[model samples]
Target chain A: MRQINGQPVTTTNSQTRERILEAAEAVFGDNGYHDAIVDAIGRRTSLSKGGLYFHFPSKERLFFAVLDRLADRLVSKAEEAAAGDGPALDRAEQALRAVLTALSRKRRLARLLMVQGYSMGNQFERKRAEIFDRFAAVIEGRLREAVLNGEMVEADPALTARIWLGAVNELVIHWLHAGGPSPAQRADEVAVVLMGGVRAPMPVPMPAELAR
Target chain B: MRQINGQPVTTTNSQTRERILEAAEAVFGDNGYHDAIVDAIGRRTSLSKGGLYFHFPSKERLFFAVLDRLADRLVSKAEEAAAGDGPALDRAEQALRAVLTALSRKRRLARLLMVQGYSMGNQFERKRAEIFDRFAAVIEGRLREAVLNGEMVEADPALTARIWLGAVNELVIHWLHAGGPSPAQRADEVAVVLMGGVRAPMPVPMPAELAR
Candidate 1:
């Protein structure tokens, strides 16, 4: 029933809500869940405590909202890459690269999601797993396609997807711990390692050895 | 210096301490650190609060001691497997199998270490990283030997080690999530995937004359 310029009041309220979430991501990313306070997040925005609370009922709610926004962005990027036309492995690699790129740009937020998010409580822990499951499903889908096309060997796509997800998560954790480098480059290396493996072929036995 | 059954008081105390840690592992593993109480662990044994406190100054201390014991057992098993005479990949697989076997038998404890422990606080987080580092180092050392002996392709041993550690950790996490099947068998499949990779060989082109 309210209007400002050409926009309705709900639009204005939604815009404000988005800004609050943006600030929440940075505050939660920087201070972690335990240390992050609502006041700190409010300071970064133009809204009052009442306005912020109107958008998010509590700090825990705000934290989960930020995580949800992050998860949505990441999952969409990966989905786009996976749905693109290319070799199955290449497309999967691109999806992974897209994920790393997005996370690197939001490195602090990435740390908050990977390290601090799960430990908050059982609810948050399950939420984190669900987010990870989305990523794993994308990878598993691509892996299944690769196998059907004969671009990959027969293997459990679900298990392989989980393994790949874990490897990528670990790499990101280490990268964050060491401070962010060019994660795009590291993503390429990870693709190679995961697709090709690390072992060298054993030398063939000599004729004399074979006789023995 | 009271004696028990002709044993020195110190020896009896040490035995009691070990018993307390064993019970602590199950309690923390089942309840996690926050929900886990000193009294619960005490009830699992014959120790009272006073007796438990005598052996472990605090619940956190008891929790760390249990983690340390778990770490020691895992590291020793990996070390023995790595030191055995065999191709490097085989040794690494054996080491991984040993880890999976140990973890499968103590599923609750493994969850405690991998999931709940890191989020407890900075101290536990740091301790978890240190334990992971030890495993990575052993893996790195074996990888170096493999490369030198031509059993593995040349690559960054340190990075590969970390990646391997991450993959194994992820697999265990998934196994726990899926409610612990025989992880030993899964470990073999993981080894094959890690060592040989998932990419299939490219098909050779047919001759032009044959096509005609």
Candidate 2:
């Protein structure tokens, strides 16, 4: 079949590597890491197993390439979001919403990254950890800005990022796996909790005798 | 081998089932769900493949049994924590801490659950949803009490519970895989963000600085 651009796409070196990575993402998302076969990924594109091997040394490397691509998109999105001007809290929220929404859109890729992402062993795991820390740093920077502006109480930025990331991540998994609710609805609900917490004060009822 | 309590553990239907479940937990934890085999679990005790099959019927069922056992422990812990007498927020915090800590303790079990807990097809996924809602209900009850006592803001209990659960679950996964900081330290950090959010107020200048 012809490539999306309608031109004859090269299946050599870098181009082959990119196609293999894309195929790996789809295959991994569908069958998970353990169940996914490198052969299948190669079959998805024009590349033979030998051709794919020329780019990725093994299945693990191909999987990491897929994860790396996804992480790059996330990092780029975060950078763009950070550069925008707004209240720190609002900006953080916008960044999170954008990332979460994007993850939701790429439901399969997101699941592969979050759920099966760590199964790739030390090398891939370390790379994933770096990406995770980078994402956390973005949040931490915005959080520090919020602190300087008196928008929130004192706390560690790293810890705050973990909480926010954890909250959004778990909610996304639920939205994807369970057929109960829409991602948008779940994201909004979680946003409320992240922002206000469950610690809002309750109203006190007035006595009847106090009525004038 | 003889029973631990001279109860003929493998002689009865229920006891034999329990033994198989326990063995499965150990095997799954040690080898991960996908790698764990039926024979490995059976070898842990005086049960043959046929005998184990009589109880569990299949490896999948045995895996489910381990999941059910963990869910029961978690449910009981949540109940005890929620029922504990204390200030509303204090109780809530205590309950959250207890559940998160328990999850961390069962790190291998948590790993198995994450990889296969929701992958058990529609029927098992339904059961997973039920267990999830049950845990969420415990959190919702605590939140309701907090609202009543003016310890927390009035909010949608169900929604809040989902968010809190999501955050805790992700934290549990990170704690399990990374083996970095203590779970308590992580939990404390999450508590701060959940309560106060990512933003912290700016520090005010001293009176001496104002004079200057």
Candidate 3:
């Protein structure tokens, strides 16, 4: 550890930043983006407001930072679920299930990540989009592999990933705003409907007229 | 037409309101909600700010009204496409196609309706949800009918509708924000993926491990 003025500098600095984020996450998660106070975060971290501002310049930046942390954890969970599985489609379904289940289990985090940021303005929306694209990339990678392996037919992996994430986003938001089946509970059904889209063409004949 | 003094009362009054909304839509569409000036709308409509206020209370109110009017037109278009159709699923596909195609053809309206309001704050988010519910209801209704008719099997119509709408929303936003294949061009691919979710299950074998 490099010492500056008889104190470990880099470790102490990063440690303080982490502590501030943990405290900020709770503050923002509890009060929402607009209501969450920077002072309150400082209080939770036992740091002065000036100290907090040194790490995060504004409430918006702090909120976005918290969201990035949350996205990181959630993406890791989804990747883990998708990494080891029977088939590419199955693993993809597990990845979707993992995300929904994680969010369903953490209502505050769900509200903060998905619903709360709307009040912060367009900047927050852009941040939301950036996070969504990250999730889409993970899902898209598996889907592209599935397509390549001939498990599915006639679907664009990139577009299919957006559709899947969009479906998950809508379900989760609906769950948060309006009382309904949790995303985890609906995950299987949603997966089937979505997966059926990209799954290989069915061998059975369609009703002649109904057939495309 | 009832006359107020010498002028037709409701006709002229309502006409002026419509004129203001038409101008407001263009202003909001071009400048977005935040950048758009009330005076600009007033200028386009040949009305005073006071005159515009007599119809709409604030820019937020005026924007919501514009969204409502746009929603009305778009919903009517979707409903028309869904009505008087062959299979419920086909009608549903047509409805989805109608929306994507309509939005694709009108990028300004799409930008205003879908993307611009993010800067306006939480109220705009609520309004977006309301409009989404209206679109979802139209889709859900047909899906429920299909479920009862045995054209589709083992699906929740309400949830399925959200999945479909969410996909469309994501695609449209992608097209608006980032350059991509227009939603209209991708409509067929999207529809098949979504509609396949609710379509009756085929009498085909899945890999034994994936049967679940």
Each model's TM-score for chain A is 0.82, 0.82, 0.83
Top model number, TM-score: 3
For all candidates in order, state the fraction of native interface contacts they contain: 0.37, 0.35, 0.48
lDDT of model 3, residue B67 = 93
B-chain TM-scores per prediction: 0.83, 0.78, 0.84
DockQ of 1: 0.25
Error at B42, model 1, angstroms: 3.9
Docking class of 1: acceptable
lDDT for position A97 in model 2: 77
Q: How well is each residue in B117-189 modelled by candidate 2, as lDDT tens digits?
A: 4333333445566677788888888878877876665566666677777777666655665678756567776
DockQ: which candidate is best? 3
Instruction: Put down candidate 1 lDDT per residue, A1-212, tens digits, no spaces.
Output: 65658776565777888899989888877766665778888889856787688888888888888988888989999999888778786677678778878877767867877777644544566677778889998988888888787777667777777778777777777777655455666765666667775223335455445444
Clashing pairs in 3: none
Candidate 3 on B145-191: residue-level lDDT in tens?
A: 88888888778888889898878877887777777789999888887
Scoring each candidate complex against the real one, what DockQ results? Answer: 0.25, 0.22, 0.30
Which residue window of length 10 is worst by lDDT in model 1 chain B?
Answer: B198-207
lDDT of 3 by residue, A118-169 (tens): 5564456578788989888888888888887888877888899889888887
What's each prediction's TM-score?
A: 0.82, 0.78, 0.83
Ranking by lDDT: 3, 1, 2
Kindly report which residue stretches of model 2 are placed more than 4 angstroms away from their true locations once superposed: A1-10, A85-87, A118-130, A148-150, A184-189, A197-212, B1-10, B84-91, B114-130, B144-154, B185-189, B196-212
